[model samples]
Target chain A: MTIASEPADGYAVRSRILNFLKYGANSNPADPRVPFYRHPIFVRVAHWTNVIVLTVMLMSGLQIFNAHSALYWGYQSDFNHPLLSMVAMQNDDGSLKGVTQIGPWQFDTTGWLGASQVNGQWAVRGFPAWATIPGPQWLALGRLWHFFFAWLFVANGAIFASLAVYRGHFRRDLKPKVSDITGLPAEIAHHAKLQFPKGEAAKTYNGIQRLTYFTVIFIIGPLIVLTGLTMSPTLDSAFPFLPWLFGGRQSARTIHFLCAFSFVLFFIVHIVMVVLSGTWNNVRAMITGTYEIEQAGGRHG
Target chain B: MADGATRRGFLMRSFAGVATLALAGCDSISQQPWLDPLLRSAEALTMRVQRLFAGNHALAQEFTKADIAPMFRANGTLDPGTQEYRAHAQKNFADWRITVSGLVEHPLSLSMDQLRKLPARTQITRHDCVEGWSCIGEWTGAPLAHILALAQPKDEARYAVFYCADPMSDSNGDGINDSDFYYESLDMVEATHPQTLLAYKLNGQDLDIAHGAPVRVRAERQLGYKQPKYVKDIVLVDSLDKISGGRGGYWEDQGYNWWGGI
Candidate 1:
């Protein structure tokens, strides 16, 4: 079925724009009333838990990455080809020069991603001190933080995923149907204009929402976890094929970094959407399992 | 009981265990009588999982000389400056002997010259340090497999512990000195690995003092800390529990993972 493509009726569009600008429009002249159970208790709990676990994992991961500020592809790093590197190259002079490089492009990332002074001494510490946990160049502590949070993240993900599957929450809600795929172009158009579904349409996730949720949960999460295991030398011996599957240990490390940044991207978009859409209502749905919708004819359901 | 109830119970118990461990802190919780068994079990689980994934004979990747780090900074204690080590170093280690004993049917003391005469294998491999830096270097030495074959470890032998002459202790406010010895151990699988070498030469030159002179055991598949330098003796054992700190290596004794494969 073709989406109207004529843009959501002007009244709905106008209300959405006003609501967005107002930071969540609850007072629609045409009050559409619907109290939908947007998020279940299990989903809400998992979401919040993941918020903490992922944040710690990301920061601690950066700490561990700082130990070796270079990334490459293949079983071993040749040092000749680095997919990404954040480090300071010593100049002819006594001073340290910070550089962040990807492929052939080099950027001076001093005091930020590459090198920065901590405790008034020059160090080759990568990713800067502020970005890492413990805020020092301690690999042991970094590993501890990373492994601890990693276990938590994996356990939480496993439980949430299994429940999501068994409960059909994924199928009934997040899954995109044939119509969603067909209507994607129109949906993209609406999204480009910062337009969101309202009333009945808001009850269900939009096409882009379903896709993003599915990708983050299924694709991004598993990729990071598996690639992480691939980098372990012990695991490499046990699962010798893991390195081959990912091209090599360094390749796995690079993929893990990329996957992490992908989550960061998802988080930014998620926050933006949460703020743009009715922040109060969206937050309420997550916390109390209740969502207020703007239905047509100023009616409340 | 319903599946949901069982799942809830499991989740709650897991969370409670995590909370207890966290509150106790790794050091204190490890000292706790009850948690010791649990933590050891967790460590065992990690080792088992890695062993299951990694093949016993799987060789670590070999690299070309071009991949070697321009400046491979010496890690850990660079100088094993014991009076005995200095005496041997003065004579170019001609008097040094590496004793292969314990749990072995044939105990042999091989000198540097004898070791040089043995069949040698040279491979360029990357050394992955637990501290996160890595360096590739060409190591030429007699295969550890051949040495173990000559020693003929008894049936009960399960581990090969390499004792180094490095004085790792910084006791009495002095810098790293040879008051304490450095040592590392490897399981039978690692000990007998084809790539495992008693490396005496690096980059076509004799091993320097900064590197482990006389001899260094290269357990290629493990982290650099597992590669002990200044080889003074090799003791085969049925178990590592009786060793100092009972964790397998000096670093492992200091709370590093026993399995330093990563």
Candidate 2:
């Protein structure tokens, strides 16, 4: 909610903070741009917390994955017939080389995937040192980081979902309407041409944005959590149907890995869109809960 | 135009620099004293949550004969290379005795034959390693509960600490790992599990050195590390503080979560 009767100094301080962040000259004081309330306080907090939690979960997860450095399907790991594996082999000259095998096909991926430089020495590892949490071959610390943040991540997601539903944030912003489906083609066309919505339409997300957010939050979120739980032995004993639902334990692990990469993919696209659309406007909205809705210019379709 | 390109290059370089700086900061922060306990608190949460749901009586999944892997991969210390272990192995573990003492009324020093004569349990169960691999094998051994019942653990007995024959290298001189023998512990719930056994056989055959021959523990619900190989002693202790590293297990001493269910 906007405090319409706010003191003059509040806007001045916010403006000063923005000026320090921005490199270019300040916007004209004579013609002030009206601010539109976009993200709520809850959304802002949840969003920022996720940025930290997700990063730790991903990096530490890679460290954990490095322990086995292989993926399989079905109940147990078929060591000989792994779906994917990272192995180190000695060459003819006695030089160690890293090879990644994916179901009969093998590729030399030294210095990155299968093996990488660690502490100025060529070490056999799945992911590079830079990618993992501890920057070393420490499974224990990695696990600690993962499990700790995993709880936080789940808690954040639960809170965000409950709040979104309770506050009508879902219905008002995220939930797709009949028009969202009907206008999908036009939205896709606009996105393809790098033409974001302008004027009244720019006040809220387009059909594409709504659909993507909906899928990521509702569908992908639950799927990842379920798949993660399926890997636990005690959980499997407690809920036998979990692994059964995902085919098996190993299959669940494979799906969990896929879901992690899906988030990465979404993150890449999300960042590109934020940068392309209006970096300052979007970032400032998340930070201060208000957006400067752009006007229809000559470039607007 | 040149200025725009230069500025773009500088921005990209600075981004990479920032990322490196952030990673370095993360690494340093991970070593902080407060952060470790903060992260480890999740271990307690996970253990409590899992145990609450899966009760003590719940059994780990059992497999059929077909599910057993052709070769159950042997990991960690495959051999207890000490002279005592070598001599014991030479006689097919005839001289080998499992000393079950501490926090018990009837302390036991049972030979292999005596342990074999006790209540035996055979089941095909999956051995899940902490490194993320699983192998199904039919294990035959004396149920730990049957032995615990005979020994009659004292009221203060809170954990069944396992002492193995395998000696680990104590390189770091961390007094906790100085008693280099690989060891693990289980709570009363896990210790008393029907499937928990002092496994003396794998696939209907006597345990070989490669597989913790003489005996190894088979705590089916826990990860492989929790099931220490090369059994030598079984000590019942109330608190883990007096033991090596005081974390309960050798790997736990190395900063692993003591709760291995996950």
Candidate 3:
């Protein structure tokens, strides 16, 4: 059951040789090995900052979106309703008194009502008393935080990207090899079988990891930034093309929501993968930049 | 050995501090009398800042023709399903005259053709709906200020009320009357805003029936609903006290803010 106390003769060497032959020639101890992480201190800081800022942005954005419970286009079509609605109180005159229950067509005192006349007169909904806290005021504050933090995010990303190219981090960590491209079926089979090395964590990412990281870096990051900018009226004036790139303000909003959803998905998968591979060890390496490797058969080599 | 404990204590203290700040922020969630004043002041301050910034700058980005969406869905009461509206529509809107009256020194009932002949300003702007959809289209129309100039609004005029053709008697108390046409009012400030216009054309064509044909008001800075369509009359008033629900717009009277600037 253990590597030690078994034998110190030809049997031990024969077992080691057998293990190497079974796994691969690359699994041999004498083979050249990749470092656990090639990420620099700045890169690490940027990554963590991005994580925090993005999380805050998403949470704050949700709060703002909740302000307008219903959405519509053109004039005022009620094709879709908010996910939740509360029953509204009504007066003897058939006027809404307040919200009594929460359901579709229920009166959400907080929701935006379009232009509609009541009792032969125009009436609009008042901002709900409960919404006063994270109301327009809070939204404005959040906007300030989002915009200021965005600068840091952009700077960090720009630095990381330039450094990644200049320092060959992209080439070493993300570049797909010719074999990875040509042997796509084998690569997929390896993933499908979950045949990655057991004890030793992948030094560089596997093919799927590389692709996901690349897409997040090149595609999702730019999208989040561009869509966020498109929402800015001031920014739109400076760069008219930005709004056009994402359709319009409304379309940009849809894209922004979709991107946030994608980021959430990625975060869940990343956390799950870390736990699956080796939770404590992976976390410790990320924090302390070092990890103790267990030798084959559960002994420190 | 002590250093590790000290570091852990520091980390714990920092985390506790952050938690305290977060909790303090969350404490505002509960409604309080004082919080309302604070929020009001904050909103006012934000509006002031936004207004100042916007005034100093040119209008928000205007897009080219290629950027326009192939299809823009008409929002709100597509057809103001009213007998009066249907009658006007049947007449090809020749009988439809926009009455510019009330406090105006010179009241006028201008036909669609007359209104179209007035000097017009065309701008490609985004229409942001509170419901969370947006569309950009080229709108061409006469500045509302220009119309007010022609009508010669009296010195007491404080608001411009849009009277729509849709009626409100049929809804059976859903707060939204199927027979009621949408109506909105703007303070003299927004009414006279340079960008505010009585739009009759969209994307270089006469407004379609679904899009409040004949004429509509475009309060460009505000949300889409403020842009009252199928406008029948523009009534200048000194006070909104007597207006429907005294909130300014139909939706405003229902509980929405009259000034829905982004």
Candidate 4:
């Protein structure tokens, strides 16, 4: 059906679908004569590498954080109960089960009904049981993975940053021109109103995207890495400056948790934006490195 | 030159390629079981190299009494709920003798009084726990090296294992309980380090029961768990292979690292 004949909602949905199939909802395809992928092969490699590394780092980090049953604010005396606790155990039927602990200082194993008792023995109930794997558990292996992958994460990030600066990616894609920065008040208002002048979407990134992405790449990423290093006693000894830089080991740990929480927040917003804009188009560009664009009164495939 | 790639381009692409491979390996949540052996080997190699690097330099840091925290929380069993420990405590731990045996030239069971009389080193240092807690405390005790000298470790002895009076039983019966009184072993290098001591006093006062009174081994380089409390004997050994789970400590057997150096 033609765009003119479609219902308003239907038109929105179709546009979304088409957008998803073309550039991820927000990304603009390069001009016809320009290369299909805006990022060079090295940049793409570095970007995906970071994505994978960061995911593993976060998951393994959660596992390590789960090791301590209690988390404190100032000192051991100031320990606060975990926000959520899971009672981990194996069932008679050879399945795993978890009993969630909620509320203040109370452990509830009430939801553990489905699990069968093995050899007439009820499953062990505690925090570690929930997260720790039984018998030659890979805690050490997880640690090694976390440490080794951390190096790659940092190295890849460094390379990406260096290349960005060297290749003018920041200048071209991120940095606002003199007018854009000077007229930020109007630009911000325009964004808040969800209004984009014609041709503006393709040539310029919104202030919010620039600020968020820049913070993730420059501020949050480095903070996560630095705070993580401070948690290591070996590293702390070798680099005395770390503990001082982060207030102390515990403070560093707190910062690390904060940074990780911020990343999770960023991730949620990023996925929502993807879905809101056009999921398929974004996913396709990320995977295949090409996107079709819709020009004024015409379509360019 | 032949590929028409500049040196910078070649280096950049090579790094990116390796990073991609590493990232690919990290992508999957579940790794192949085969990765375990490789990781263990890498960890071992890293540990050995780290040990070598640290050998030439001083390891544990020394602090002042002012730096010592006002209170240090005791981890693990506060009191060994054993009749022997109770009886010993009733006698004021005066009769408690620490036996130095195994691969030693001179095996001796020395009384607490006798241990106190030996040459000692006092230092204020921080005890960091793996659970993300830390406390600084002043400890006065006989240097482990001095005690090892009195016991005269045999040339073959590689590790000094501290056996404690506390018997840790698995009351929960998960088939994991052995002796609850914690045991830890250290390589001879660390065992003989000048700073390594068998602490008898805390904060200028005799140690309290909850704080491993009578005697404890303070391997200050490691986290709090590595410091075995209520130490009653020292057993020198050639290897740790036959120890429980072959890792080196009560917690080490149950998932903690053997070399828990801070």
Question: Residue A224 in model 1: shift from native, Å?
Answer: 1.3
Interface RMSD of 2: 0.9
lDDT of 3 by residue, B159-262 (tens): 89998876645668765456545678887777888778899899999898888887888876667778888898899998888876876777766545455664
- lDDT of each residue in B68-158, candidate 4, tens digit only: 7666778876777677888989999978999989999999898999989999889887677876566668899999888889889999999
B1-262: candidate 2 lDDT, tens digit per residue: 9999999999999999988878575788888899998998889899999999889988888889999899899999877787778899899999888988999999999999999999799999888888888888999999999999999999999999999988888557763223378999999999999999999999999999999989999998898999999888999999999899999999999998889899
- Which consecutive 10 residues in model 3 chain B have the weakest lDDT in total? B35-44
- The digit string of per-residue lDDT tens for model 1 on B87-121 reads 99999999999999999989999999999999999
Better of 3 and 4 by DockQ: 4
Better of 1 and 2 by TM-score: 2
Cα lDDT over the full model 3:
0.65
- Top model by lDDT, which number? 2
Per-residue alpha-carbon lDDT of model 3 for A153-253, expressed as tens digits? 67778988888888887898766676656766776687655455534545566777777788788789889888876665535545667667775665566
- C-alpha DockQ of every model: 0.24, 0.60, 0.13, 0.19
Order the numbered candidates by lDDT, best leading: 2, 1, 4, 3
State which candidate has the highest TM-score. 2
List iRMS (one decimal) for every candidate.
3.9, 0.9, 6.6, 4.8
Poorest lDDT segment (10 consecutive residues) of candidate 4 chain B = B22-31
DockQ pick, better of 1 and 3 = 1
Q: Return the clash pairs for model 4, or none.
A: A20-A281, A24-A282, A88-A129, A88-A130, B167-B180, B168-B179, B168-B180
Alpha-carbon deviation at B20 in model 4, angstroms: 24
On DockQ, the candidate that comes out on top is 2
